[model samples]
Target: MNPLPTACKDEVVLTLPTILLPGLGIPASAWNNVKAHVPNAYATDRLDSHSPLSLEGQVNRVIEFMDDRDIDQAQLVAHSMASFIGEAACRLHPERFTRLILVDGSYEERRKACLRIPIEKLIPHATLRAIVQEWRCYSFWANELREIQRSHPLRTRTVVIAAYACRPGRWVRKLRRQAQQLSALFVPMKGSHRLMLDRPEAIAALIREDPPQAQRHDGYAL
Candidate 1:
């Protein structure tokens, strides 16, 4: 793969390594297509699938993974639930991440602490085992979402890509407003929630594109 170009005038040839984080329950192989396009990219395996960990623990694991590989800083590309982990990790340790790309990320209101639903019971038996194994992950995700709601806006350069199918909806609008507040570039792409899997080449192309203009509030056209 060719080295990714920067948007700077000096045309720096150094390409920052990329970290691809999959959503909850998604296998590392899900990022295979995108990984194939970026030779320097590393796709992380599911962090809490087997032995469950708290959200903070997952963030620590991500940092440790990078540190173990001697990666000082890299572009973080996260999808769905992993977006929460990426955002939190970046906020906690801003120096470890150069940029953040949230692909069809989930943005919801802070979860109620007292409201505990039997998620495993609600799902079918076939998926019950997986849910049982991932119950802690689910809990951590909800708690993390609440924390993110009360957290400060991100200072790192950020890009948010929402699915076109979810356009003209309240969720997308909310995400747009959040992006504006963070001065992040928001892009609406033609795909489903699983946009990366649906259009890996397109996703990879966007990842390879130059970073968004710093402190820009306007959204980008496809």
Candidate 2:
């Protein structure tokens, strides 16, 4: 791994290795701008290699990447649907997480709304299930995950970079609220959901900024 340069802005010293995860169907180049600014951060499109159809499989792949890098502990920066995979990893093995950055992680509500329509009427149940791995899968829709999140300390911060006319505003608000309750400092950015593509410099600048860390006395949240 290349050494990360000292971030220009005055902030807490960063020593943890940073692992960046891409969104579903997103290429590693998507993180180019952000990674360019964060010298120490590593980017991978490993998930894109297989074009895996399920989010849980994406989560497992992240673990494998961590193992390959000997990353017992590192910060996770997840954008778009990648938040689902990153969140799952953090939940399953909080010991490996020093922090998590949720970039554009509020698209779940829109997903749910889209999945609400009865596609089963148009397609066979098995076909619909195979096609829509996100909605019907227990990996995403599990109430247990929600229950765990309700009281658990996230032990991290949130950076939300939203694009113009981003639908499902309510879900974003909910995420913001949850971040606050966890005592995390949230930094909000505006541009497009494709912030990495449209405003890579700005996204990189934000990634370079330090978000507020939560105070915790217990072990990992998991």
Candidate 3:
């Protein structure tokens, strides 16, 4: 018997994750917690190493996935590094997305810090699962925790804005240095490392606040 197709393109509520992180340390089945609430949510599987590590690759994969499933656009809710990819997609192909809801994290900070860290000297296996364990274990007591807290979406947008603005060109430079990058600035929220897992309800509520395509049919976009 032919196996069932993995990607689902139906026009239901959609939410995607950051590609860098591996499943947020949560079980795939745990995603049902959010999916149960949304109408039809599809989660993209982890990317193969052969795929480009640049943010554009992530965006292309999503676009391709949707295309394969006959989906034109979707409502994206990205977590962590995935937020960067979502932002890139929005800027490059705004029409392809209806609404965007970035979870409690950002890639602008992560990519820079990770690049500086001597990963090969630190840990050869730089997989998402390994990173999660490293975080939980307090492996790098450098400045990850502080940065993570600062990137919380719960933190007043004003505060986050000020934090980034005060940093001068360092943050922006890191983002700009990346050639094929997502061009959206992510909003930080209040929560620990696991933003979505720690605050799914809050995220879901925020998503619900976004007016769907059906509601915008009145010729007055929200």
Candidate 4:
């Protein structure tokens, strides 16, 4: 682990170790820019492509990574589909997470469905094959989402950063509604879904900012 710079008394404080999880089919390199600005943070490799297909398996991978590094607790930053994995991990082990930061994430429940064609067999490229395998795990994703919905109002502090640029109004509204449902702090960001890639500095700032005291919103616990 890297050491923090020396500081005068009351000048500097430690921040929670941060774990960055990328979206489905997106490489961990997508978080390189954001990682550059964060200290004591680690970005997970592309688990959506090569890791286990089941959500429980993916969550286990994260736990194992933390355990290997002796990280007892961390702040999770998840983007897109990885939000499902992060939420599930936190739900299963809430004591291990200090905060959950979800970027451009959706909590809409999904139902399992079979793909008519076997794209993996048809596609020769390795990258395409990986994507096909990820798609094949739709049932896992659906089951995880269902479990998260059933276990709402996560014990860990939660924040939802919704991207508004170039996105449909309804989609943005849906994200806002989901944030409300989770009783999470809602932050509206000006960018596309790939905020970590396009606005890494801003995202890092949000990560480093002190979490606000929990408050009630529309009678919902936050």
> lDDT per prediction?
0.72, 0.58, 0.43, 0.76
Q: Compared with the true structure, what per-residue lDDT tens digits does model 2 show for residues 12-125?
A: 454567788776556677787777766667787742223354555666778788789777777788877667666666766678876677777644433232234445456555
Order candidates by TM-score, high to low: 4, 1, 2, 3
Q: Write out the backbone clash pairs for model 4.
A: none
* Worst 10 contiguous positions by lDDT, candidate 4: 210-219
The deviation in Å at residue 203 for candidate 2 is 2.6
Lowest lDDT sum, 10 consecutive residues, model 3, at 154-163
Expressed as tens digits, the lDDT of each residue in 1-222 for candidate 1 is 234564447666567789898886777789999887765798988633243346777788889878888888888999887887888888888888888999888676555433345554565553444545554356457677567647755678888877766344776777787678667878766677887788787678667773443222124443
Among these predicted structures, which one has the highest TM-score? 4
Off by over 4 Å in 3: 1-30, 107-190, 210-222
**Could you give me the TM-score of model 4 versus the true structure?**
0.83
Off by over 4 Å in 1: 1-12, 47-51, 114-142, 145-153, 166-168, 210-222
Q: How far off is residue 211 in model 2, in Å?
A: 8.5
The positional error of residue 65 in candidate 4, measured at the CA in angstroms, is 1.1
Off by over 4 Å in 4: 1-10, 47-50, 116-120, 151-153, 166-168, 210-222
Query: TM-scores for all candidates?
Result: 0.76, 0.64, 0.50, 0.83
